[model samples]
Target chain A: MPQLSTFYHTLLRGRAGLLTGAALLLGSLLSGCDLIEFSPNETRTPEAYSDLTRKNLERLRQQPNPSGGDTVRFVFVGDSQRFYEEAEAFTQSVNQQRNVAFVAISGDISDFGLIREMRWVHDRLKKLNVPYLTVIGNHDLVANGREAYQKVYGPLNYSFEYGHTRFVLVDTNGREYGFNGRVPDVPWVQQALASPGPGISRQVVMSHVPPHDLDFDPQLVSPYVQALSTAPRVAFELNGHKHDFSIGQPYENGLTFINSYSFEKRQYVVLTLWGEKEFKLDTVQY
Target chain B: MRRALLLPLLLLASLLPAAAQSAASAATPDTLSLALAAAPAAEPEPAEPAAAVAPTGLTAQPWYRPHHLILQTAAGQGLITAGVGYTTLRGRVDIDVLAGYVPSKYSITPMGIFTAKAAYSPWTLPVAQGRWQLRPFSVGGFVSHTASSGLNNSRDGKYEKGYYWWSSRTRVGGFVGGKVSRVIGRNRYGHPRTLGAYYELGTNDLYLSSIFTNLGGLGVHEILTLGFGVKFDL
Candidate 1:
């Protein structure tokens, strides 16, 4: 034991040994606790990186709405998967915008549903001037992604209210579940959309796969869409996974669905909503 | 799902006793031959003189026997990993099989990762008068399969073929590392047994793909994973 201690001390005493020790220390610091990843799909995350949805919501609650009117304005984007350069630029662009309350990402934050991928996206998104939130996507459910998403963000389906709006974020990637009839949790969405607290003027639903897409469960489509259309003060449903932007009333009931631009598109929509379903869409290219 | 989880546990359970038995019966002269090749005059005096009596010629052990045992953590393998390895080519190459575990807290369910790895070290420098050894550089590759009861299969029958080209359960990765070892004692074959500590910097296939596709977007450091371990020569 004495020899071992002396050996270590001798090794650390030399210039080369000092350099090696310094390099190791620097590497550990640079990688943070994330350097020792048990698995790429492992759900463990540092406190700062975990429960982001809740943290972002808390941050949003603390910051007063920049638009002082009865209006809510948020930058909408999605599919930031592996788009690190674009995310940095997106953050810079969003920071420059005035009166933006927050950023809403529809889904698909990580291409591989890996913790590091989510952390990478967060590393950039955390730089934005305003708080940002995310919904779980099909990619985020890959392998151990469900747990990873729950650990890194908060939940697969969650709702938050800010600036007179109730945002219902749900998981709609049915194919990932083998088209199991339980996905999108129609009952839960209905429950969330059905309740609007005081000062809540409109409801905005967000998810990854829209009902029309093949990835969505065909069996639950009618029930899921019906839940949204019948909900009172519903503005429009927001979706990603298509990687492009589209807005239409595909159903006979005239329920509007607004698709968002993926991060790689170098564009995002700024949605300004007020007075019930009245809203304006402005596209900003970074 | 239970069967998938059980397989790695069974494999791990089966390997330990076999490694212990091999270590017990490892009286063959081949161990000395490799030790001599590694360190010609580095032999430490034996604590048990009865175990040091050796035949002159190199007699090979059973092919299935491993020369060393390994325990490691991280590097996207598992929280704790244990394995056995065979060193060959005068200690320049090592081939190993390992089983690793991550608890339910870190995943949807407790996960079992089974891995096969091969490493090559081009240089082994004697340090501190051969009482310690330094392998300055090692390049290696590994393939691992993860089995968890609650893991959602990426390639399940739910999607059309090629929907997701990569398999979430399996990973192929490469690493570069260095190791430092100290001679511990003499084995039955009169070889200077060593205990070594190592560190590996690695990246998996999905990480490689992420960085390859986003050269300007993701930095090399972001895709890297680090693992640390200790190896004991039997």
Candidate 2:
């Protein structure tokens, strides 16, 4: 009633109360949308929109396996930065498939490293029928991005097991850290690369910056590459920052690396795995 | 939180009738509203030219000096920011320099943002109650720089030329909103002063670009942010 009276007062003052109400309503509706930016650099996402990486991992495990038994098949895409429209299309395409267990985006989740961008990508990707995963990108390291990424996703380096495969996600954006030499965290990579006792049939590595990219620490390249080449039951490495599709053995050490297409490419990849060191790559255009 | 928000609304509601009653009794409305609004602390005002009341020797401060003290939050500028600015263009333009902070308790690195904003208010309408002046429309933009800007420039040439294009430190955006100001009383120097409550809806350059590039998929409300503030004109 008082608001109604304010509406009357606004008309008396030449159109107010309803206008005020509209403004107020819009504000309250978008209250948690990060539109009222405290600062573009701060990673102040609400609880509902945070820790998504871990949550998606749990969602990945919930999918029932087919009678194909030991085989694991999933979709791969990358670089959702500012490609919200394409992200929707990607999600739509990924949802139509029946055999896929999850979708992996190889980093550059946000273009500017802002929390809003991370949340925006999540808002689009969450519509998919399967869970999606991402590694940290160089772009995600800008400003307070490292902190923001930690808030929305989990650690820069984490590992999860699905079926017979062990997926290891690493933070290889060393140039962002001024070539700290500690990054790529050789010790951690070496430890994770070690053969886990039985039940883990295949080891897959993923990161944002490709091993051949200049952004990876020059000093750590040899060790980083050697770790991958020698890792037990290791398959091909996966990455995204390049925004295109490519598969090659850059080191000539028999270690293969595969790069996925960015959201804007109107394409994505699907990996079907069965048995040790055996896989098939299928590129789908949406 | 709800009660705190309603407090201001209730105060505005209660003061209306009192102002209307005083205005009805006085012979002249403007002088009467001014007098009643500034009443509790001073004598009833008499009709007189603003210039004529000026006493010799005690001159009004120069125009370039800041006309008000401002405290604000949000609008993508800062978490909590404070600054002072001068109004110009017949009270239509306001320029402020603000500094904002976020403690290490929340962020891994406590962040600081320095910003400058210019707002233009095109109209001010007097409410039926008290000395409230309603600014029905205000529009403006701001540029902010964060201390930890590391978006485009790699730490040690880690990136090749044209790698990441956007600057993480510098942010640009625009906002629109309204304000309510009341003639509380006079300052110690006998200068008429006002207290205002204002709000703005805003979006930064990156957010705007995201909307622009994908217009159909995004909404203006998605890009917009909100800011609330209070200012005391001296």
Candidate 3:
């Protein structure tokens, strides 16, 4: 609501006018510049995490666990891209492969996760043959986006398992306004990785802001990395938002953090976990 | 041109004999006796003059106003337009098609549009003569379908997508205006071209139903356009 009253209406006023002299002057100067997306080694706020996580965790305990059998391969995608277009393409591509049970989006399902974006994304995601879960990103907090996200995508921090693997989606995008020295809350994340349901052969953590990026706090990275590394089943930590592809070294706890590239122009990552420990990472382009 | 002049000249000459006959009858008793005897026969002679000047009002005859131009600004866009038009064979219905470019400040470069409109007024307001100048005004409704603009690659260094109704969209609205013409300088055709300024106000986009919500950096809005253009009757 603050952004609606503040920036959105102001933007509308800025857009109106018979002669848009001011907008024309301002828009021209800003269009050609390539602004920085993230700074170097920035840290998140050190403030205590909100009670919403605990409330979410308590609710998560009530949900039934997924039943597993043979190999279940569901595609992992990132970025909402152009909402419906991205959703349609992802659905079509996944359907072509068939047998996909679910989808996990890294983050940024909407540029500004307002109610409309929430509804739009929700409608598009519904087109998928399987239930899809989304992680929260910075851009998703435009208006009452937090409430909308919770209402549409369920709890921000929740875990669900399918067959032999477990998926933990967290809201690494901190408070809507500014960041402090903390992002991946160690206690909440530690609990999320602890898997309450049936034990799986692999564990994968999904978030929007990658710890490798400087925009994420340096303090939060160590604890997050430590948590993921400690899990032997945790073979991949898939994320997006750098708009580029990156693969980090095996952490101290021996975990691979793969930052997925932007989903623009049909880009996605396909991870094939063979048997129990062996795996292959393939970048699929359509 | 010389052949065109012969018809009206012949018509004027034909009226001379009738006028002379009526004059002779009015002056003599013998002529009056003959006039009374020939009254029914003489009736057709006077009706020819009325037919010669049949166009009685300003709006009665059609004028093919083939040139017009306009400059419009609204909703963060600027437009320049010009076009040509003509009247129907019956000399009452009028139609014109115009095209223009719309440049916006959102780095969405200029767009082009083509619109056609038609209207008719049964009678033109009487023109004031002498010190009593006649200020006539007429109101009629018109609808236009504007074409999407072509991409402009110069301003933003990118091709602007056309303003298809599916994309940027087009609007449908009604238009009304008044013409305050006190006849200006004669055009090359020798017809009095009226000069007046007209204003039109209208609403568009009745099909789209939008919900207004208060979101961070998001809000719903309606776009309204008000513009001034030259007005004349054809």
Candidate 4:
């Protein structure tokens, strides 16, 4: 009986050793495999995926031969939510165009606002021949979408100037915040519009939720629209949440608001600007 | 707030591995099955008397008694999750229900998920003098409903039908893995109680769809997550 007990103990110890080995391997494998996700909205991304705004800006800034900072032609599009097939077509269409300097998306980068959806859009948009940037959208603010958008695209409200144009990307999705009255950051927009660098000829504001839409905070609409209308060298405001193509002055204050079609529409607009308060809009179908 | 949400999960995790609860349950199972019973290894044969005692006619347990309790992390279910399951079909199939938690960050609120899982294991090898089992392959799937804000299953009346597609609250995922268990002695309820550790590689419907659409770019591993946990007979 003693011998049998000893043999059983030996077997248990051996099995324990094997289990330990397997556990160790599993530990290492967990780290190596990207599949071990903690949550769908989890915020772990590689260096290349994070701080994308800085990366894209760096790419834009490091161009060697400079243009005369005068005529700027760029692709303006929006609401690229979960339209992979359309995104591919959009990219192909944009690449074929001549003299397009970068691209702008109005918002709604992801439908459910999951990190996976943002990454999918980014992965597809990354294929564009020219550098592209986006503003935060209502859909992008869903769940942990605000964080995911900020992490992946940089800031909800940020601005950069290239070729006599100061592109100010603002967060205008007030309804996402239950109309807390602080969104659209009127003060920030006024300031950015107030101070365009020397020789800048135009300013274009872009956001997902347009001021005219009910989603925009009604209380702050006057202040927001006023800032844009009064801003220096204001050309036109671009938006994307409508998923349709519309170009008009919603407030009829001589301030133009251009809404880009969603990727599913298989059409995008190319805006060409040459002088202060002067622009041309062209739509391309993919 | 985050700490408060996770406090219960941490407590459950700490209470799962102790096998003494299982031992005490052999005498009175009512408390063991209902309470957070951290069971100890059931040693069927007395160490010194090895082959001497072969007790007869152990009482059979009610069919509804849980076969095991599971505590797992990741697998896209939660940062920490716990569940109870019943094993059937010659102990090769399991059906479980898990409650999982996810911590909040930024604008996203912390959420809890309810998951129903079923697994089928085709082969189990008995080793260690018939006191242990090694299941090399376990295949299963789960339907999890995320009880979180903003993951809406239906759109408001303002939007047209199919305005926004895809179900946000419900998710279907599948996993494949292996388990190693140690057999304990029979309980008074006439059932073999075993303690096991398992690991699974899993992916959800959305991830799988992404893989299928972008097969050239995405790898099977990119969409998969690992779920490891302890399982014990109740």
In candidate 1, how many Å is residue A79 off?
Answer: 0.5
The residue-level lDDT of candidate 3 at A255 comes to: 66
lDDT of 1 by residue, A15-82 (tens): 23433344344445544566788888798888888999889999999999888777999999999987
Candidate 4 chain A — worst ten consecutive residues by lDDT sum? A11-20
| lDDT over C-alpha atoms for residue A206 of model 4 | 89
lDDT (Cα, tens digit) per residue for candidate 4, span A1-286? 6975565555345443334345544654675345666667665665667788888888877753133448788898888876776777787788888878788989988777777777767777788777888898888876567778778888999998887788899999887776789998899999888968777888888888889998899999999999998888888889988999998876868888889988878888888887898888898888
2 or 3: which has the higher lDDT? 2
Q: Rank the candidates by TM-score, best first.
A: 1, 2, 4, 3
By DockQ, who's the top model here? 1
Interface RMSD of each: 6.1, 6.0, 21.1, 5.4
Question: In candidate 3 chain B, where is summed lDDT lowest over 10 consecutive residues?
Answer: B150-159
Error of 3 at B205 (Å): 17
Q: Model 2 lDDT vs. the true structure?
A: 0.75
Off by over 4 Å in 2: A1-33, B1-43, B46-64, B148-162, B186-192
Separate DockQ for every predicted complex: 0.37, 0.26, 0.01, 0.28
Across B129-210, the per-residue lDDT of candidate 1 in tens digits comes to 7677899999999999998878888886988889998988999999999988766545556655676778889999999988
Give one digit per residue, the lDDT tens place, for model 2 in A164-199. Answer: 889999999888888889889988988997976688
Docking class of 1: acceptable
Quality of candidate 3's docking, in CAPRI categories? incorrect
Candidate 4, residue A245: the lDDT equals 94
